[model samples]
Target: MTCMRCGREADPPPRHRIGFPAPVKERILQSICAECWKEWEGVEVKVINEYRLSFLDPQHREMLQKACFDFLKLPEQA
Candidate 1:
């Protein structure tokens, strides 16, 4: 698989365990490599802490999803 973030040939991430919808999940699985996803996992924690995001808020979840897409270098969602 060619990573969308690094543009390198590498293995795909393990699975779609996150709560994103099927289409978004499919895009990530196909475009994001395992290494990038692992990196994002680390970044995700920082983002949550820095922003004081609570999963109980829908807006915060959307914000995090946008951040994830930006970090992955994916195009904007429709």
Candidate 2:
């Protein structure tokens, strides 16, 4: 397979866990190629946190945004 992000060819897929609390069985957290996974690994924490925050209720948006910005080392938008 090819990496979705980098377009690089991938090695054999490895087993990975997804979601919380023992993780969902038979779930593939990421199916992208290895090269893409390497790039994504650098920002995994920030990306996952942002994903979680994005799904939260609207009242938490501001706080979530702040947290995400902090994690990304980016300035918060006014």
The model with the greatest TM-score is 1
* lDDT (10s digit) by residue, model 1, range 17-46: 556768888889999999999999999999
| TM-scores of all candidate predictions against the true structure | 0.87, 0.34
- Report the CA-based lDDT of candidate 2 relative to the real structure: 0.42
| Candidate 2: regions farther than 4 A off | 17-31, 48-78
Report the lDDT of model 2 for residue 9: 67
Q: What ranges in model 1 sit over 4 Å off?
A: none
lDDT of each: 0.87, 0.42
Clashes of 1: 0
lDDT of 2 by residue, 1-78 (tens): 644344556662344522222221121123345444344445656654656655456645555444433543334442
lDDT, model 1: 0.87
